[model samples]
Target: MPVAQDVIRHAAERPSKLAACGPGGELTYAELAGKISGAARHLLRRGIGPGTIVALALADPVELLAAVLAADLAGATPLIGDHTWDRRRWSQVTAPVGPVAFVGRPLPYAAGPPVRREPRPEDPAWACFSSGSTGRPRAIVRRRASWTASFPHLSDLAGIGPDDVVLVPGPLVSSLYAFAAVHALATGATAVVPGRWPARRSLAAHLAGATVVHLVPHRLPDVVGRSGSSLRAAVVGGAALAPGTREEAGRAGLHVLAYYGATELSFVAVDVDGDGLRPFPGVEIEVRPEAGSSFGEVWVRSPWLADGYLGDAAGPLRRDRDGWVTVGDVAQPYRPGEVLRVRGRGDGAIQTGGATVVPEDVEEVLRKVPGVGDVVVVGSPHPSLGAVVTAIVEGAPPRALLEATARTGLDAAQRPRRWYGVLSLPRTATGKPARALVAARLADGDPGIRRLT
Candidate 1:
């Protein structure tokens, strides 16, 4: 069954249950189903149906979820566009898809024919753009079954149930938060999103009844300090969770479950005890050796794999004849099927002198240094080595502190040759450090970068 239909079924069975809560206010299951049905009729009147793409640019999370579910119910593929984009950028993104109608806000309910057609399990239910931090964002299309197939496993992993309310703090355009919201609805749980992105008020307001929260690692520090006692699980992803942040969350009585995945492959592995990531139920992983390296590129085969990019062009997603796909991430098996240590992306590898260093490996070591709040490692231009490892730190720690940390934790090649202190680092929408932008700033000699070497 389509996820929307599943939500509707819940409404019929439990009409009084709370389905969602946002800035707009609380909505019961029956009310939400009515809104979805009304939105579907509204879209059908606008000539959006099977084989037609509808672009949604709503700012309100409640409206956004309703519009998406309505599109599926109407048998049209819904592309969730980023509301932060300006006119030109948004136009450029949707030009290729050529959606029939672009709705930025809630449409009026004009009594129209009810949508009777249901999308097939293999039909494209929704579309989302990649983060585009590395390059241009690709339009990724996912089939309905791809997501529904993993719902049971993901619900089990996160302990999601009808009684639990899940808080997703990020924007709906993000795959992590979108999955959280949709998963909650599909499982008859209430999903609470902030009225606005980067919610201004304390997250405590949204956590009154929420037990689980989906958050990026960068937001964990602040949230851990102010979270309510009801917050039992913090599902951190979109970036690596720093060791300090994890410890802080533990001290606050929050169970931090860090997951590792990409847009192409959903929910690959999850870390429950802060040790390492183990594959999800029914997910398969294979690490094959790369030339001149001990760590191999990680490959995944699962039921949750995306169909392909929208235009079917070759991009980061590489697939073999047997259906295994890789996003160029390199890793090593710690306990085969039990734990896998992800080194970093193959393209993110920094070649310094003669050795190749993954920035994530070096960044992990730097994050442990005293006075270091956050850190990102990138390759800087060098006269002899072609490229030298560089560390951009959030706090201004003394040169000796960083050098000593590097000396003990990293090898000569992996240790940063230069240290740049900054008040903040450029980040993507999902709160990950924009390494490409940072590297460009370093190359162009940005004035804010304070060299400590």
Candidate 2:
């Protein structure tokens, strides 16, 4: 069987089943399969053969997924380039790799079908950018099998099935959206993609009938908090959900599914509503035996772990020969059943006034403030405290909003020392907040905002 035959196989068995939905329109399994085959044939005619590099630069999800599958079927190595990619950087990445085919968008010149070659389980099949939380972006690569292992867990947690229509609001350039899209198609479900995620547009898309929606908590409140929709489930990641936001979404008849995962490790654990976090049946979680190990750094070994970062053949993503891997996330083993609680990313934790603080815990509180759309919390270097908490909020709130949220019925240590407002928080290509960018903006003296600096 071919590498990309899963979707086609499902389509063959359920030709009339719903396969995808997006801004353009809806497509049935039979229709998507036809399009994939057509796309593959087109690539073949253009001389895109086995082992060739194909970059998808289009904005449309249907076309994007179709083109990706086509490249896989035609035996090409598919690398997705974001529409917002820097032309110079794109050239640099593609230059070392040699000539690559373009999909979803028009090419400059015409070519013939590239040849097809079979890829082993270890061959590089996918590449994506780093979240850029700590520094400049780096390329991360994964093998086909490792990428596919997250499918069952993702589908199960999202409650995806033949009858479900999954809405992907984030960009497919990121591993999150790409995996969700592939899972939806492979499971014979409908996947929807919007040109961009705005509050009204997202609500409209869901109202038009999106059974399962993927959103960052930043986007969730705007879509489900005020407007009504036919959404049954919402898988949230990229940021933490506010205390009241999840309850509000639940009131709107949407089951908010919180996803805790990294690009290297697909999904560590998932929690629905307030049910708590649980390990996916497909993965084994190990807690590090270091000091202050309260689900401290989590070590994971899953079938879905990526093969390795692109171009680095020395095997950097590997474990200590014992099959344990880490993406630098702090997790504590929760309760009886080996459940895990994701504290936050290792790099994002801040040391404030001699106590270490996880910004996610604070951001969750800030997000619940009225009029606050999204927020990012970072620890700015401070002489006395070592590091002080600073926050950048997407929406402007009343002067009392910060204090009110800070008084979370908790101690003063949990409150942010500084808060500022911005029109929009800078996000990575994948719609995740770019912490470094936020810090840079603040350093540049962005005016018109309150600050406790």
Candidate 3:
């Protein structure tokens, strides 16, 4: 069964349980099911199902959930659209995905039957835009069975049940928060989604007593700083999880679990209770290093992987003759199923002084240093070295602290030659350091980033 049908089961088993809460207020499973059924009927009556892709361009989390699950029930694949994107960003992602039934407006009501028939479990249930901070976004379509298989595995791993209240912070347009919201409903847990992403200082109120809160790692330090948070766990992903952030989370009595996942490969590896990154439940991963490369490409094989990019030839997702897929992420080849450390995207490597430096390798060392919250390392134009390794980092760190850490952990080529500081790095909609934007700022010498002595 698709995840949408799971909600119907919850409606029968625990009808009065809170299904979801957002700006539109809370809805019980029974109430939510009624709305989904009505909306799904409306979609099918209008001849939108299976073949038709429904673009859910909703900023309101509550409405998006209703519309998305309803679209699934109606057998139409829902494309989660990011409303926060400007016209240019939107066009960049959508131009390739031709002819979708864009649902920018509220869904119409059904005049007749509530449901015609169930959607195929094998057909696509959702399509989401890739949220890589440095690269062009592409639409990754997913089959209904992929999410269906994930619900049970993920819920069991997290111990989510009807008693848990899961909080999804980021906009639903981003796959991170979208999965969190839908996963909560699929597991019969109450999902609370704020109208907007909460400010760093205001996150505690949203987290208090919530069993689980899903967010990106960039915001983890600020969120963990707030006291009196009785959260069962804070599940973070979409960026490198800083060592300092995890340490701070421990001091605040917040359990933080980080996962390394892409829009194409749903949940590849997860760090449970700070044990370290291991293959996610039911996901098979291996590191395949190219010749003369220290870092190896991490390939994953799983049922949860996305179908494929919609209509883009230049996308990063690649597959071998075998069923394994890789997005060019380089990682340390630990023993088969043992702990893994993702170096960074291969295309993101900096060629400085005739040696390649992976930004994540440098960032990992810097992240362990005191006072560095988050960081992005890019190649700065250098006449002698082609491009020198330059770092634009968030958090106010003293010059001595960074220099000392770099000197000890990094070699000559890997160490950042130029150091710049910002109060905070610009983040994508998914809350990752916007590397492309920062690279532009570096090129233009934007005053937003002041040179660190």
Q: Candidate 1, residues 1-453: lDDT per residue as tens digits?
A: 667787889999999999998877778999888889888888788788877777788888898999889888888888787776666777776665654467788866656555578567767887776653122456788888888778888777767888888888767776777888998999999999773334435566766567888876656665675735488788887446665778888888888888988878887888888887888777789987754444566899998888778766445688999999988776764446567877664335564553457677788889998888889888765544646788999898898999999999887888888889988886645577756556656655779888875
C-alpha lDDT score of every prediction, in listed order: 0.76, 0.66, 0.76
lDDT score, candidate 3, position 171? 73
lDDT of 3 by residue, 1-453 (tens): 656677888999999998888876889998888888888888887888878888777767787899998898888888887665555666666778777777765676675665656556567778887643223556789897777678777777667777899988767766888888988998889999985567655566777657788876656665665567667678887556655778888887777878887878889988877778898888899888644445566799998898888875456588888899987676766666578877655335564543446677788889887788999988775544556788877888887889889999888778888999998886645576756456655656678899999
lDDT score for residue 138 of model 3: 65
Worst 10 residues of 3 by lDDT: 346-355
True lDDT of residue 322, candidate 3: 89
What ranges in model 3 sit over 4 Å off?
Answer: 84-92, 132-135, 200-202, 346-453
Q: Compared with the true structure, what per-residue lDDT tens digits does model 2 show for residues 101-159?
A: 65647322223443245667656677665442212234566777776766666677668
Worst 10 residues of 2 by lDDT: 106-115
Candidate 1 TM-score versus the reference: 0.75
